[model samples]
Target chain A: MAQKKNIKNRATSKPSSLVWIMLILLIMGEFFLYAWSRVQCTRMGYEITREENKYKNQMNMRNNLQIELSRLKSPKRISLIAKTRLGLIRPAPKQTVIIR
Target chain B: MKFDNHKQISRRAAIIGIMFAGLFIMIGIRVIFLQTVQGPWLSKKAANQYEKSVIIRGKRGIIFDAAHREMAVSIQATSLAAYPGRIKNKNEAARKLSNILKIRFKNLRRKLETGRSFVWLKRQATPRQVQAVKALNLKGIGFIPEFNRFYPNKTLGAQVLGFSGIDGRGLEGLEFYYNAYLKGSERKIRVLTDALGRQFDTGQTNANGLGGNNIILTIDGNIQYITETALEEAAKKYNAESGIAIVMAPATGAILAMAHYPFFNPNAFNSFSRDRWRNRSITDSFEPGSTMKIFSAAAALDSGICDPNTIFYCENGEYRIGRNIIHDTKPHGWLSVQQIIKVSSNIGTVKVAEKVGGRSLYNLFKKFGFGNKTGVDCPGESTGSLSFYNKWSNIDKGTISFGQGVSVSALQLTSAAAAIANDGILMKPYLVQAITDQNGRLIQNFSPQKIHQVISARTARDLKRIMETVMTEGGTGVLAALEGYTVCGKTGTAQKVSTHGGYSKDKYIASFLGFAPAKKPEIVILVILDEPKKEHYGGIVAGPAFKKIAHQTLQYLNFTPLRQKKHQRVLAENEVSG
Candidate 1:
């Protein structure tokens, strides 16, 4: 009876030690994932900030170019160019046709 | 010996224990005081050291025409600045910068030598100048992006657009009127810094939040250009002091164009005087000569006082009213109301006003939107002087009938005429068509609003026919007649009020108010020329300009000419018969 009791105690001790080892491994894996994700998030934050600035600068540049185009296409400037450089003149009243 | 040693050691232990208790009590008191008394203050100080704040100016809104063409735009420009503390060789820096920026060398050197940590070298530097400065790459020099207001059309609609100062504050015109909506809000961004005062990256946030809303005006760019070119020519040709031309959609009271002579470029507004910047269409009032007859006729006809054929003897061109004799440009007898308006007879108009009486006439003028604000979406509109009927003398009544004693702004006169063209329903004039956000989403839309019905449809129709006669062969405004379209118009040649209190014989204001396609009018135009030389008559000076603007506007609007429509109808009839 004494020998049987000692064998059961040893058997329970072996499984309990394996369970403890698995728990320790799982915890280590979680910690490693958390640290790696934090590093990636920080790097991406810098990248997004730099990209946002580039986008803003590009938008401003496009707006400036559009303004330049509008200035060039202004009616007064067009008329001046037409009259002086292109030597164009307005048509007489009869020259224009009216379609009903 | 052992007993004496024990007593000495016990005494030493007691002394050290007392000293340790005192130190613990002092440390506890200090910790409590620091945690409670100075906590808030010290935390704020620490935050100030570790945080960085940057002020980003909001971008101003752009102004557009009806067709979404840019009238005024804001462009990003670089402003040059300096850190005076970091600047070395201040004299050299100033000399080099002044040459590039065209600033005074001594003044710039003095600014750079100041004790201030930062100083503005130039606000809104040109791209060329910015590039030149950047090439120098001088120490302590910095460049910051700023928005600068730019008018693409230069002087095309200077008075309407107004201008913004270097600091982006609206100074005049629509810019001043809609300043609250046009000027943008400022933003402050706070960043977290580490222990050594280095900022940590905050993920991409919209750098430009909500900016000021943009405005789209009711003005058509092409129509405005046409009107401006024509008015400029008329002013230059006649050698007039100044001139104004207004084109309005009679039905909706939408002012398609409002132009004034002697225009100035908004980009260089400082070089022009204050007078040149005034929008004379609404800001300036003048005695509208015979243009008042049209309103007087409406009052008489609407009140059942007279018919189109009611006859009145002209007194052979002279009429005496309360110690004053009013003279006509020419003598006429037995003239009907229709004929009177065709000739613009002063005696005939006075007699008609007498029949309508002063009370009715005053009410008529008030109802026509004179002597009051037209409530146009423009700044500095004048409420023209209209004395009460009780205050009118006999001479005042007679002269007011012929548009001498009463004064009116060009906008009021044109709007009133537009009411008549719109079958007597007065519409409040508006310029801004819509307000939009930075992303081009519509925030608010302004539609046409009818102020009130000023006259009956029957009365407006009768007046249109009578005014049509005034543009016919024998009328004073014959020059205003269009070949392919029917025109209803009135002419006015008022002697300008002299500075000394009487009418000036040499100076006259020549004006014409008219609308085309008399049966169903689309547009009403008003042209006024001040102190036109050689010819003082409205028919000669302003009548032809009225014709040109009307014809061009009708063509631009694609209104089918009367002949073309009639011919098309005939062809359709023949096709059906075959």
Candidate 2:
């Protein structure tokens, strides 16, 4: 009777198929997470590079615009336009009245 | 028989195995030789074939006026370029590009047909041209980004600000003087490329830690414009060869505006002559003529040997020293020290100089910064010509007393006059007011620098009073007088020095140096006209210009006339009551 009981316990000690299935699924999940993170890192690197280039281009455009604006507001240009287009003339000292 | 056959086979197998092992040993030796000796050389050669580096230029700094208006700035521009080897249909490309770039078709075609890999279509193209070229989108044509210097105010302060060349190097004026501070740093990018010559990795390294610094000058744009227009008109009206007007703050020695006629537009500086590029105020020296009388009077007063009431004999407009005879414009009898200056009598000035003695006069000249550079932060300054006291003969002393033998730059004359206006203290003249870094952080700030005390405050006050008489009704510089404000000034009519070492009778330099509201001075202005055809007198030619500049400048500064002061107060009181 004792020998028969020990044989019965040994027969029941092998792992079930369901346990094997869970181990395979966990390994596949780890591989998927690793692939996702790698893809995310590569994508972020490209985005950062694009943004840096955009920033540089914007700065160039801003500097160009500033030069243009300053040129338009120059004294000679303003005075010329005032005389020709606006028909303006410099006021004489007698004509101007200081409030204070 | 079986045993013999088996032994023979074993011997043959052993010999073959030994030969195979020897071949393996030879191969291992060759591997070690290649790894140890040729590995580094081969790898470097490969890297040389695929690696690339490019230089990134930092932006050049901006130049600003005292009011923070942009006088000069560096702007980003695109230059059209081409890889000739890659360009197919060269004629068609050239024809289309020439139309857009406004270049000749033949020239563009020749450039595109060159054997070289790269060629420039245009450097620093206009924006409209660049846009037009971009619209074509031709193959092998590309654009290179570059920095171009732009002067928005055109000819305003051209000589003072100078100009940078297309290559961004400063070539003249303040641009050349402060180049090291105004030039920007550069960056280098080292790229690692693959076998196909495509870049795979890059390391960006800055060559310098800091960018260029911006310069804020003491020049005021409005005042500069005013001075320039007034000087231009004076030059034209007088039919003069050229003109210079310098406006300065007397107390601080800060130059507000330095105007030059025959002004060149820095944007098109090349279209003008190189002579126009000179900043004549500091670069050229000439006889001060009677402008030196004010200094002579200062010497006499400061020496304690004479006062404004001191008397001297004029020798009836003719005085002989050695073999040289000096003549005044008009004959005069005995005149007071104040009267000598008021009439600008040459004979009177010589008699006073004799009383002061030669060594004392030379010392006075030295104290007034004659024969020396003012050390203003400008390029091409002349030290002027003043002989040593030991070299002075009686004739030299007499001629120099009337401002003929000695010479000085307009800048030096202005600085000396400014000392009187600043209560006898001479300040070092400077154009740059402050230096700022790229991020607008102040790196250095310049303030008023007092160099020496040229005269006593009492002497300066006395000299001011005497100079004021120069603009009175009977004086020479009456044209320089403002209606309500007192103008203390001296007029100069100097004969031009000929190349043969003699004076030209026909040519003269007319100049007026003065400051307004004499009691409490604000601005000292100098106007000099070279070779006025219509008028040869300083009081008649340059004095009116001085008055105009002072009046406009005073009005711009809101310095009310003494008559206007009471009127303004009453108006204010009335407004408040209403």
Candidate 3:
């Protein structure tokens, strides 16, 4: 009878310790996952910030280039280039032809 | 022995338990203290590490011409700043920056030696200079983005568009006029930063409606260029002191071109004198001279006192009224009203003015927008001096009739001439056609506003017919005639008011005020040259410029020439027959 009682107590104690181990493992896994996700969020934030800066720089470059294009396409400059470089002149009123 | 061992073990256990309980109590108290006392302070300190509230400014507004061509723009430019205390090798850094920035080493060293937390090394540095400095990788050096105003057209319409200051505030011209609307707003935003002190994109950057509203002007860039070129050529050819030219759409009073010479680039406005910064067409007034004869004739016709054929004695080129002799350019016999204007006879105009009487002429001048602001959307518009008719002396009547005693601005003259072209209805002149937001959403749209009818349509037609004779042979404005287009114009040569309280002998303001396709005028142009040296006659000095501007502008506007229209009609008829 004494031997049987001792075996039954051992069996109950094994399940309780096993359950405690599993609970602790689950809690630790959740904690690590939360920490890892925070780190990834910070990394993505840095990346987004870098991309935004790049976008702003590109926009500025586009604006500058547009301004340069406008300057190049200035009527005065074009007229000068046409006259001096291309050997062009404004047509006389009589030389002009209107289709409509 | 066994009982004594048990008692000792129990005692040790009690001591260990008490020690652990006391440690737990201390930890609990510390937690409470931190949560209650240091919580707010710690949170703030933590926030300071990773978050900051900063003020970001929007970009200044852009200025576009009628065709949406950028006249003025603001571009992103970088400025260099330094933290004086943080620089490790001040002399080396300053030397490197001096070469790239074109600054003196000593001056840069002095600036870096200052015990300031922050100092500006250069504002609005060129991109090449910025890149060169960046390559140096000097410590304690940082860059800040700022807006710098740029005029791509340079001197094309400088006096009209004006310029902004380094601080992005408009200082002159339309820039100054619409400063409030052109300057961007400021916003305070919270930004998140990383451990390395770099900002993270919070997506709130574009949330603020920060950019200033853009202004669209009625000015045509091509026409403005043509006008400026013509005015510059005329000024150079005549050796004139200065010149101003204005082009207006007769039907709407939209200012197509306001050109002035010698030209000054608004980009480097500071390098020029303050006098060159002024839009003299609106701000300066000069006597209209013979151009005023048109109005005097209009007054006479409108008042029913004289018809186009009414004959007036010219007094043989010189007439005396109260000891003041009014002389025509040449001797003239009795000429009709139209003949007087065609020849621009001052004596004949004076006689016509006498018939129209003083009060009637004064009312007519006032009706023509003389002595009043044209209400143009420009700064510092001068109200040309016009005294009441009751204050005129006998000589004043004669001189005023010949456009000597009266003064008018180029803008006012153009606007008044436009009235005649628009069939006697005066329209308010305007520069800014519309204001739009950054996204091009319309904020305001300006339209042509009619002031009132200054004369009957019949009177305007009669006046137009008489004015046309001025462009024909034997007319003062013969040079102003265009091929295949009827032109009605008047020439003006006024003796400038001298500093000694009388008219100067050597100085003259030669001017031409006219429009093309006289039967249905399309554009009204006024050209004035102050103190031309080569030629003083208004017909010779200003007429060619008027013709050039009119010809180029009308062609650009796609107005079919009369001969071209006829040829096209013949071609269409031939096609139909085939």
Candidate 4:
């Protein structure tokens, strides 16, 4: 009778399909969470890069404008214009007054 | 049996643990190597792969007058640039900008289509135009903050103040002289921003960021204005080709006002020509005519070679020296050296020069700061011309005796004249009073620096007395008299040298060098008018201008004569110096 009972218990110990399904689900869940966070991180990084590029471009334009402004103000250029364009002359003491 | 088994197990366990400890040590050593030596290299490699750095620029400094008035300043401006690759609608952007900024739309469109990453749509746009562009909110269109120089005073003291470039650096005058002290320290910062574009503090920080310094000039704005105004009026009234005026403190050498005609506004620098932009006070050189006699006379007095009572036998107004006949406007038989200077007698000054000798006169000229730079801190300064004594020609010496055959800048002439006003002490001509940092700490200070006492106090006093006589009825001193004020001055009508070596026939530089209250002068004024169309005589063309200007200046400074009571003195009391 004991030998017959041992044979019956061994027959009932085969692996169930439900255990395999549960293990697959756990691995898939972790992978999905990792993928989602990675997408979020990449998006954040892209935004920062874009903002930096924008600032860089703005600064370059500013530099160019500053150069233009200075070029316009050079003494040589102004003097050229004043002498050729405007009919002006130096002042004289006889014409102007001197006060203490 | 269990105890024996336990002892064997413990011994085996200890042996295995020692092997594990060695493995752990090996891994720890690897980590130390990676962190200590290779970390920087790896980090740099990583940065090279992903990071890009661009240099940031510093803003230039603003310009201000002595009165703390903004002569030039930075205003927020925008530039329109295009990302050629990103520009999907070049025509649209150009049209929009042209409409908003009033730019040449066709030109801008052509620039945008050049297939470059960046094309400037506009530079230095006004605030309204920038706002207009921003309102459009167009994509790929951008603006950068920039500063532009503005001149609020227009053409006032334009040459003296000079013009700045886009970088806001001084190119001339006070601007160039104090450039180093004006340019401030620069700084850089690594910044972090949040999603809302607000500035966020980063643990990483940097210093070395700085703004420009401020310069406090010795020029008084009101004085400059009045001086310039009077100069303008005189130039117009006299129908003169060019004119220059300067007001300075006799003792301190502090330049209060320097006025020149044909000045150009720094903002509109391009609108004028270079010839009109120089400060004549320092740049232009001419024979000072009678003004030169004052120096010669002072030299004779200081060296005890001649005194006020010294008399010279005049050859009835015409004298011959070394095959050259020198003539005076009026011939007097006998005259004292003092009377000669008082009358501005060319023949008389020549006689005095003969007795003093040429070398003595030249040495005196050097002592009086002629033929040398005034040591003024201005660029383009020309040291007046003094032919070497060793190289002197007899004719040159004779001509130089009466203010010819040599040249002196307006600065040199005026400064020498100032010596007499300041009791014979020559002072350095200073334009900038002080230089301060951004926080207003003084970096430089200019005080009353005396070059030397070129003449004794008594000599100066005597020269003053002689100059006083020139303004009186006895001399060519009719036009330069200031009513109610004791005026002493000299009149000069120098024949301008022709480029061909002789004097120009019609062209003359008429000038008057004068100071007030002969006993104790508070101000010294030198006026020069080149090629006057009306009266060419220094006393007539340059003199009346002196009277008018001096009158206005005295009122401006609240100056009153020493002997005359305020408002009680008659106009006759102020007679023209002879």
Top candidate on TM-score is 3
Look at candidate 2 and give me any clashing residue pairs: none
lDDT string for model 4 (A1-100, tens) is: 9999999877765445556777789889889989989888766755666676577568556845664564465434555576689955433323333343
Tell me the deviation in Å of residue B219 in model 3: 0.7
TM-score of chain B of each: 0.91, 0.88, 0.94, 0.85
> TM-score for all predictions?
0.87, 0.86, 0.95, 0.75
Share of native C-alpha contacts between chains A and B (below 8 angstroms) recovered by candidate 1: 0.49
Judged by DockQ cut-offs, the docking class of candidate 4 is incorrect
Q: Find the candidate with the highest DockQ and give its number.
A: 3
C-alpha lDDT score of every prediction, in listed order: 0.89, 0.88, 0.92, 0.76
- CA lDDT, candidate 4, residue B463: 90
Which pairs clash in the backbone of model 1?
A: none
Q: DockQ of all candidates, in order? A: 0.40, 0.30, 0.71, 0.03
> Residue-wise lDDT of candidate 4 within B348-415, one digit each (tens)?
88888888888999998998888899998788899979998777777677679778989999888888
Docking class of 3: medium
Better of 1 and 2 by lDDT: 1
Query: What is residue B434's positional error in candidate 1, in angstroms?
Result: 2.0
lDDT of 3 by residue, B476-527 (tens): 9888888867788999999999999999999999999999889889999999
Show where candidate 4 strays beyond 4 Å.
A1-100, B1-76, B193-209, B563-578
The better-scoring model by DockQ among 1 and 2 is 1
* Interface CA root-mean-square deviation for model 1: 2.4
